[model samples]
Target: MKFTPVSGSSALIGAVLALVSSTSNAADLAAAEARARGHIAAESARTMHDAQHSYAARDVIIDDDGTEHVRFDRQYKGLRVIGGDLVVHSHADGRFKGNSQTLAKSLRLSTQHKIKASEARAAAVAAHGGEAQKVSEKVIYARGDSPVLAWEVRVNKAQADGTPSELHVIVDAASGAVLESWDDIHTAAANGTGTGYFSGNVALTTDLVSGTYYLRDPSRGNTYTTNMSNGTTGNGTVFTDADNVWANGLLSNTATIGVDAQYGTAVTWDYYKNVHGRNGIANNGVGAYNRVHYSSGYNNAYWSDTCFCMTYGDGDGTTFNPFDSLDVAGHEMTHGVTSRTANLTYSGQSGGLNEATSDIFGTMVEYYAANANDAPDYKIGEKLYKSGTGALRYMYSPNLDGSSADCYYSTIANLDVHYSSGVANHFFFLLAEGTAGAGMPTSKTCITGNKLKATGTASLTGIGRSPAAKIWYRALTVYMTSSTTFKGARTATLKAATDLYGTGSTQYNAVAAAWSAVLVN
Candidate 1:
């Protein structure tokens, strides 16, 4: 998550200066500095006029190198803008060099508020199909050429999946039209334990504070677990014990869920460090904490970037149990990984890729753990849905669940990200195990439900799971971007495979064939 300034070499400075001319005069520079120093309202009008852009300064980061990155949130006619944030780069001399923006165009828009704030809130709640627990309003520049002024209505409530949902519903202020809406709760699902629901009869790492042992892992970045007492939010109370022994096979014991959460956290940390050389979720050697026993009758788990923590829910205990399984933990933690890296936007094709990244890594983490109780497979949340021997999603044949797509199609982007992720999941499975069913339990199918016959022409030989996972990790960290599409994913993975195993090696060929088999091309 660290944004290191590019070295201010002559060549780099020249390149940057080429893209941006010095638009601000000395007075403008002073105003910008004043704005950066918290005189935002005082200098807002003058700064926007001088810069010829309606952007409000959000952050000013002065790097160790003589570079200043002034982050700005765009505004249109005195309203805040979303997806229109940009960072203006300048030399130590305050010479504006260039800027980076998520916005695609200028923020000129009709500021007439045809739709009232209450109407926007009602529309957002109606879209959510629930009572809004909280609502806030702001103006945003919707994506595309000539960004339009829209009301960014933020709604927070409990979703059907047992996770608290933060939804951003963008309503056009001038036209009273719904521009876009997306869920902000990035749910996958998490972990610890004396006896995990999945990892049975296991020992837990604890920290002795005063006379009690706290549910903290001393070996893994001091990662710990807390009991939410069946509530929905907040950092719950940390489990403590007079004796070192934690859970005792009692489902009613809140500490039992804590055990599964803590153990899963430890295993996920090990999986990243040992398998991928990643330090932690952010790769900054810092461990993320966990909240267990979240909400009564809850049945989902989620990782929150805002909280820098993961939350697990205690299921209804009949069809589902506590969301503290190993693979679930891995899956949720990988969401943190995706947030740090690529940061794939949580909608459309990129969202599918984002979800798939977590599923792929989560499965690998389970395999890497090699825990006998939870045998590693291409199934996600399998332990959570053991009552019917079903899973949240299946990587080998995603369509087996009757929701996820097994292969890509022209309208794949229209599907829910959880379902669209099937294409990439199937691709990863094919890349690791091959289309011939070698070392695999079964063969795969295309989107058209065509049973893939393993003939010599269409058969493929895999290059092993370890290499496949490494290539994917490399692609995610090095090649992918925020707006990457399925086509871009193909190119990114191809480049990663080429970088790792050469241009025409078996690994590279397998990656290409796998994507092709999944209809990505």
Candidate 2:
């Protein structure tokens, strides 16, 4: 291991050159950058092999194409070492970086590590609960680097009657590094208690039998699955010990699966199928899966494509069950639908649209799931008592929250994805529900311009959630893409409506008017 200091310009040159230079010292140059990046600080590396392997690691590999491969703990977490020096950046966050300079820095990793997969796995297992067994080894051979070994360990524990709890582990092939791990710990007491349905193959099953609720990932090969039926709420909701899912009593279900979650899942499932005719999240008839009772006191829910499942948190106990709202479930599950279909990159306008898409569909799902138990509402997070006041989001009127946008503006990009989502949410509301003036069905009035109106205006005011959802579903699943913006969404939905009903039909005209009302067109 050697160190060299270069001018700032030279550092940039070296970082760039590491990509093009095909010399034997290329690794040295990369290692120099890695050393500079504090990948292997002397203090951390000083006691290597003498006693304990105090491993504080960072990724410092820059490829010839200038793509950076970083393994920083704080940044690029959840990367699994496959073979050789090659570690697989499996998570979506790991694969892409919005900042190129940060990426460039990762590319300059010149240092080589000779870590064995078995050792890394043992360390990881010990760090975790250490309930692992049958640790098998494999080699991770990457091009132009030292080989990395990995271990495929299994956690084969059983319930009282010996029902196997099959847990899987994928460690660094070269150095026993635990890259990823998953296990199903608890089962539900009743089958139907936690069960909800998603479109086509996707389903949200609260394992009342397993005492958990699951968002099934109906994608092929069962990539990302969630197992969270811990005996107590929030007790068991992690796919891996390294995973963090925000769970609390937000939706407020005991060990019993929250009812709103079931409504949301069912509605979202129905919306996609009935409206867009999507077979499921994957559009292949295979359904997605959901799991409840994830982490202890978890407050947020997430749609994980890696597990092909959706997860809900109990919320802050005193507040809400994140899953107890139809809109929330629709929102999370829509994320999965977006991932499988458009694979929207969550940044810029695309990111905003992606977030808005969730809000839009979630709202649509709410209306679709018009259960007598949970009346359909235009408000988001209404069921979950987040702020102890209103829903998590609002579509008809975004400015209702000081945080969200009421109308489109250039600065919307700077807003959080959720807040910026207001634009799209508003657009959807206006499109289907129309400008609320007179004769609207809304409990609340939408004030656009100087006009304060109900949800129903003219015959358009009577257009219920079903028709509007149908058109929007078509736009989202079939017409919209990852790059869609607010304006683009308007056009897509209008086109969808026209295609569904004749262009001359009132429905198409209504969609057009709604888009106009929202000022998206």
Candidate 3:
């Protein structure tokens, strides 16, 4: 091979241009953040925030006409405040328009401690019931009926089956009481498709370093897949090849699985950027890495915010195959998106919305791929099973899963988030495909105390998949909060439709009717 080098002047010009571009982005973010801080200062003077609270900008969204939305995290008296995050919306000229927040009141709690840090750690350890591995502790003001002093404890442990038990336990700093605890590890399991190991033979953009081609996507945020070698811990090696070509579409080559993950991640990246104008998973033009062959006979896949990456499992072969399907990739990556945007609390109605958001986007990614070998459908994790019909959940009619609710119910919040997600899934399906499409019920009957039983002549008319997805994405990023409910989702999506289309437009009406069909009102 022969190569020609650019002249010194050309190379210097290229370097200077790259430097200017990088500096411009940083300067833009800094200016917007300054404007947000000014707005926040005005609000604090007006008592919307406490004088002791400090705001740090995490994200910035600039509209076509220059309107800005700045997302911020809060701290008080040198202690982090959980659930104290908020978004500030401003006019093109930096005038504060309004804000999106769940903090109904300003922080007024005293930052005093009655219990020792060791005692709080002990309480967290006892509540989690795992080996005492104290990762870190932050004295945080946790949100509840009111903000209270607490210790946000991190614990590291593993379940017997190799699943992570990285627990985030909240212990009351004043009483040493275990207030709340949740696993940081979120699992999305059981589904994917087609010939050539889930995704068909496809093109990939890889990294060529020192005469070796590696499965790293340089185009899409540098997302690369690694080989775990079936180990239970740590990021494994990045797959490399002398020739750019990869596996022969079988398990005989581990890179086959890597191909599936790589393709999935790439397709998902393109879907979000092209469809919604999102730059990347975190909307920062950076990619999340992937790990294939995680643990021996593991049957699950997950996205860890702490690591900012996607991890896939090689199934036991009885229930699922390797979880590297395109939808699986989309689903897992959406979890990261959810964490970065709304940071939806992973419990109750919001948790279900979180899961459903992944399912909805994953299905969209599958369709976006338009793979000839793999057919598209509105089923969650269906492709993982030996039997094609064994989907983890159904969207058009979630009740077919036996546990998921097809309509909103009073106790829906008490169900597991995976099952409760049925309501949103059903709503999205009706909004996109309506009650009379492929694999859909011609008449969807629901009376779970929602008054109107939408069926027969009252069935909803779908606007289209593109509009429906755009509305949902708008709602998710621009309107929904950490603790949004089904009713709130209805409102958010309605507003989103109005913003995208117009008030009382067909798309807006369809969004309303779809929510009504699912009994979210």
Candidate 4:
């Protein structure tokens, strides 16, 4: 019942062709992209050789006042440069506000590499014990001071315990050594066949080919669900029905779990599309697919950016339940959201933020759906418990889990990214609901204490959940970098608040107070 240990950066690392597609914001975004492109081209040409550096537009944002921010992925020569991502900022009147990038050094690394692609793949497979599916050279700055020409090798394999793994190994092309490696499986933690057992009776759109209904949503970019047949590999068969109605919420039926997964996927898609204006996971109209009943008794769920899909598992019947619940679905899919925006490195504070982002959005998706069968709450995996009590993690007070920290400390980064997420979770709770109001979720952590204010007040104020969510969404899409830390989050949220509600607004002050309550400052 835990979503720990996997980092999703490698899954999203590559050439990204993200452009805002909403018709309302289309013309404004195009102009913003053009201005930012000119700035990037001028800077690169003036500084690094004639044209050694280039950038591809990823995401664009234009505030109500016409202030704009454009995100880009940097390229050295033809190779994608990891951590060389930058955001182009401009004022409402179109004056440049300079570029915001994490890469501090000049881009002048030699693209030539001594190691052969075969050799790099061999080394990667030897280390991880898997077939080499892909091996490409890239310039990586996320791991070191100077940009490194490294081999991005993806080994197709599963962990020893049968957990599906796409081990992405970064090998130094010069040193022929492993730079870093992480599993690409973004798990939420597990299923059956059949309208959903968990989501209540819901409406669904299916493709009717020759009167046979295919389990696909044509409206939401043909988003579909498949049965994994309890296998650890393959894309599986897409669910089809003789009748338009899929199934009742019955685990005995093979597609019973698929119904829940299908319902969950659609809800998450609607949440992002309507609430945050994200067209899809990548801000394109395309939808990420879902796979349910994965690998017999596999108690987990995950989103794979490489496959652009979500996978679910049936609980072992002891610790967890089928992980096709609404919030869990939203949690896993938000990893895809993080992949597209910010691309937060899956280590240290950045990784914690990545996990926290999923939790925050996942919880919001629950509230957004307002599902009657499943009540909205701050507890993740609350409904997925086999015992039907307790939760995977408590957002109001992370320390309730014994591992997650409710307060930020210098060494908090030493913990797993999942546990380190506690502080941000606490901050978000305070930002959305205030200091544990009567009858609201209570915690035995710092929020209940007087640490939030200098005056030793026991209570902290909150802006409503919707406004808080909007601020976080804006901060994530516009200001956050791959390496943003807790302190950096404070700056980003304040900026987002100012952009949305103005500098001296109540929402702006609430963001500051929430961070202060969590000791981020």
* Deviation (Å) of 184 in candidate 3: 2.7
Q: Indicate which candidate wins on TM-score.
A: 3
How well is each residue in 406-519 modelled by candidate 4, as lDDT tens digits? 877777777778888888898899898887665576543353343222222457767878999999998898888777889888999998899889999999998988887777
Ranking by TM-score: 3, 4, 1, 2
Runs of candidate 3 with Cα error greater than 4 angstroms are: 1-24, 44-47, 132-143, 191-197, 438-445, 450-457
Model 2, 1-521: lDDT tens digits are 01122223321222322222222245644553453333223322221111111111222334343434332211111122221111111212223321111111122222234555446556656745445654454422121133233445655554332223444455554444555443332111100012122112123333222543343222222323344654322324423321222233222324235333443555666677766655556555555555666666655566656555566655545555434456667777787776654434455455667777777777767667655545666776665663445666667777666676656665566676666676667666765665553444342333345221223233235365677777776565445544466776776677668756878688887776665554456
Local accuracy of candidate 1 as per-residue lDDT tens digits, 66-90 = 4555555444544555555444556
List the pairs of residues colliding in candidate 3: 191-381
Model 1 clashing residue pairs (backbone): 80-139, 191-260, 191-261, 191-262, 192-259, 192-260, 192-261, 192-262, 192-263, 193-259
Q: Which digits, one per residue and each the tens of the lDDT, describe model 3 over residues 380-489?
A: 77777765555777888776767777788777888778888888998999899877866655647466574223333456678778999999998888777776778889
**What local distance difference test score does each model get?**
0.70, 0.48, 0.76, 0.76
Report the number of clashing residue pairs per model.
Answer: 10, 100, 1, 12
- How well does candidate 2 score on lDDT at residue 367? 66
RMSD of each: 8.8, 17.4, 7.8, 6.1
| TM per prediction | 0.75, 0.51, 0.88, 0.86
